[model samples]
Target: MRPLDLLLAVGVMLIWGYNFVIAKYGLAELPPLLFMALRFGLVALLLVPFVRMPRGRWRDVLILAVMLGLTHFSLMFVGLAHVDAAVAAIVIQVQVPASAFLAMVLFGDRIGWRRALGMAVAIGGVAILAGEPRHSSALWAIGLIVTAAIVWAGANIQMKRMTDLDPSTINGWMSLLAAPMLLCASLLIEDGQWQAVTRASGWAWMAVAFQAVIVVIFSYAIWYRLLRTYSVNQTMPYTLLVPVFGVLSGVLFLDEPASWSLLLGGIATLIGVGIIILRRPKAVEAQAQVT
Candidate 1:
């Protein structure tokens, strides 16, 4: 990666890191689901013109929209609403392992014993994190967040299948498709919708705009470009920083607790997931040939 690309990746890390804080703050003014709906709606509207639905990928786009956009974000925001952002950040990092496991089962992608052990360790960390309820509904909320991760991984795998399309096109069109359903769900589930809209402060409005435009649209477009230019394993590890940022941002902004279990579990999860993440696709293929 060039210095500029590295910088862009770092910038993405910071934005996503602080995303938890932004969402937490934004949710203070609006319902979690509604906030997601509005955020994606703004993203969809902005990208509506430039986004073209790719050939041979309408179904993939819809699947990605549901997996990546609606199911992932909705569960994530709801989980964030219930749990501490920092821990939520750490817990969500388990998505890497979730993806690895799903790949093994769904696609017959190779998973060596080392990666399997890492998965076990990662799940164990989650268990430790969940055992402590005083830390903020760790059990139920973690389930929601993990579900978001699995869905996201499935979406990513789907994205990888659409070889002709770029990531920007996928990101834009998926957001547009997912927005309306999110909006309708928000309306049905959350109250004080119009009031939240009317009473939102300038900063809150800016938060929403920042999330929609910067985080969801522009940054993701840049990320997908990076994914195309680089290897997935190389790019995927960079996302590990997102949760790191999430922890830091939540601590600084939300004053979320920095407990021992969170730190320990986070470290264990990172180390475990890193084992799987740092492995090369070629190595996996080689290992598969042997097995």
Candidate 2:
């Protein structure tokens, strides 16, 4: 990767990593589904003018809504409600191996022996992390996170199928489709909608706005560019740092405890996934054509 691209990648990672802490703080004052609804609603409004239906392949667009926008965000928000964002960050990193393994089973994609071993180590680390959590709710939260990752992996495949559109166009349309589902879910599940809206503090509104504009709208443009320009496996490893930042932010801001198991499992996850990412195809060559 060029220095600029590398820096961009790291910057994206930091934004995502810090977001866990932000989401944790956001959740303190807002219900998970309600917060998600507002976040997507704002994103939809910002993006609506730019949004266009996916040309020639509407199925890919629908897939993106379900996998990338709806399923991923909803489960993740619910999961965040159950655990610290930092821990959620760490645990969610396993999606790399999950996608790889899913590819192997679903598409017969080859995972050379080394990658196979890495996958094993990563899975073991996740198991240890889940077991180490004292609260049963935390374990369930991990399940929710993994579910979100699975949906995200599916979305990645959908994105790969749509080679016709620019990243911004794709993201705008997907966000638009996803917004209503989230809003309806929130309305059905959450009580006192008008009161909740009125009672929400400025900080909560800021959090929702940041998530909508920064995290989903802006950051995702960068991310989708990366996805389109590089092979899925090639750019995925940078995501490991997300959990590291997540955990640190949690400790520093949320004052969440850092347990031995969390620390060990996190390290194991980073090391194992790092090996997989580094061993995969170089991204420099692929990014050149896109850039």
Candidate 3:
């Protein structure tokens, strides 16, 4: 990563980190599914004109949209409405381990003992965090977010199959496919969609715009550019900064308390994820062969 690219990576981290707080604000004013519908609908509307139709993988694209755009975001935003933003940020890191585990099961990807240990430590940390008395009421919400992470991991697996497609085009088509599906889900499962839209404040609308345009479109455009320019190992590590920024922003802006459990568990989880992510490829392959 060049110095400029590093700065861009950090900028994307910041945008994503603050997104939890932004989503919280938007959820305050609207139902979770409806808010998600608006976010994806706006992104689709803006990018569909410029992005070309995906070639010969419409089913995969729709599946990815359902897994990532509809299922993941709907559960996540609803969980955010019920839990603290800082906790949401920390808990969502489980996606890393979840993805690794899924690969092991689904594709026979072999992870070494060290990586296995990292997954255990990460799961343990999430368990400890959830067991905290302060967050007892949010256990269900935590489960929802963790399940969302699993869905996200599944989407990542789907993404690997679509590696030839441009990231922006994938996002654009996924959003286009997801918008109506999510809106229909909102109509069936949630009340007050129309009322929420009618009554949404300017700040809430701004939150939606920020999520749609900045977080999804702009940051992802730059992210794909960086991935093209740099090795995955060089750029992937910076993502650890997301939860750091998320927790800090929640504390600073949302006045969310960071308890001892949160700090310890979050640190453990991040460290574990870091180890798994930074491990050498040859080591992983060697372990797999031995196993």
Candidate 4:
């Protein structure tokens, strides 16, 4: 990667890493589903006019809308509401191994012993993290986040299948389809949404806008451009920095306590994910880029 592109990649990671803390702030004021609805709605409003249709792939785009936009994000924010941001960051890396396993099972993608061991180590680290005493009360939340990761991994497989679509187009249509569905879900399942939206603090609304505009639209535009400009190996490795920044931001901004178990398990988890990401075949690495 060129130095300029390297800087851009790192910028995206920083924005995304701090996004956990930002989402935590927004979720404080709005219901999880409602917050997600607003975020996607804003993205759709901003980008739908600019994004071209995926031509023959509308059905797949809708599936991505439901899977990535609705299911994964809803569970993620709800889980974040219940658990510490640092934990959410570390645990979400499970998507790496989860995607690898899914590729093997669903697509008959072969995994070498090294990748297999990486998957085991990553899962084991998550188990250790979940078993920590400080996080006992959050086991349900952790479970939700892990399930979200699986859903996210599934969406990645879908993305891999539709490799011809532009990333921005996919994202735009997904946001367009998802906004209404998520709003309907929020209306059905959550209470006091009107009150929450009306009473939301300025900072909370700013967080929502930031997530939509900066994290979803701007960061992804840069990310896709980098992927187009450089090899996946050059760009994908920088994503490991996301969890690192997440942990650090959680500690600094939220004053979240990181127990020894969290630190150790997080390191082990990231290491395992790094192994899977860095050492996997190029084909597998390309699939992992969808995350």
Which one is best on lDDT? 4
Alpha-carbon deviation at 280 in model 1, angstroms? 4.0
Per-residue CA lDDT of candidate 1, range 1-291, in tens? 888988888888888888888877787788888888778778777876876885777898898788877888999888888888887887887788887887888878788888888888887777777777685545777789888877877776776666567655766787788888888888888889999999998777887898988887778777767765666655667877877788888878878788788777877887778787776457443332211
Models 1 onward score TM values of: 0.90, 0.88, 0.95, 0.96
Task: Please write out the lDDT profile of model 3 over residues 1-291, one tens digit for every residue.
Answer: 678888999999999899999988998999999999999999999998998975688998999988998899988988999988888998999999998888888877778899898898888888888999988888999999999998998888788778778877888999999999999999999998878899999989999999999999999888878777776677778889999899998999999998999899889988888877876355333332211
Reference-based lDDT, residue 88, model 3:
91
Question: What TM-score should be assigned to candidate 2?
Answer: 0.88
For model 1 the TM-score comes to 0.90
Q: Write the per-residue lDDT of candidate 4 for residues 1-291, one digit (tens) a residue.
A: 778888899999999999999999998899999999999999988888987995678899998998999999999999999998889999999999998899889888888998888888888888889999878888999999999999999998888877777777877789999999999999999999999998999989999999999998899889988877677788889999999999999999999987888888888898889888888786676654553
Q: What lDDT does candidate 1 reach at residue 280?
A: 41
Poorest 10 consecutive residues by lDDT, candidate 3: 282-291
Please state the error at residue 286 of candidate 4 in Å: 5.4
Could you tell which candidate, 3 or 4, scores higher by lDDT?
4
Best by TM-score: 4
| Candidate 2 Cα deviation (angstroms), residue 198 | 1.3
Model 4 TM-score (2 dp): 0.96
lDDT of 2 by residue, 1-291 (tens): 668877888888888888888887678788787788778778778876865765575677777887777789889988988887767887777777877776677767767888878877877777778887484657778899988877876676666667567766776677777778777887887777677778878878888988988887788788767766676565666777788888888888888888988888888887777766655534322422242
Ranking by TM-score: 4, 3, 1, 2
Tell me the spans in candidate 4 whose CA falls farther than 4 Å from its real position: 286-291
Instruction: Give Cα-based local distance difference scores for all models.
Output: 0.78, 0.76, 0.87, 0.89
Backbone clash count for every predicted candidate, in the order shown: 2, 0, 0, 0
User: What's the residue-level lDDT of 57 in candidate 3?
Assistant: 83
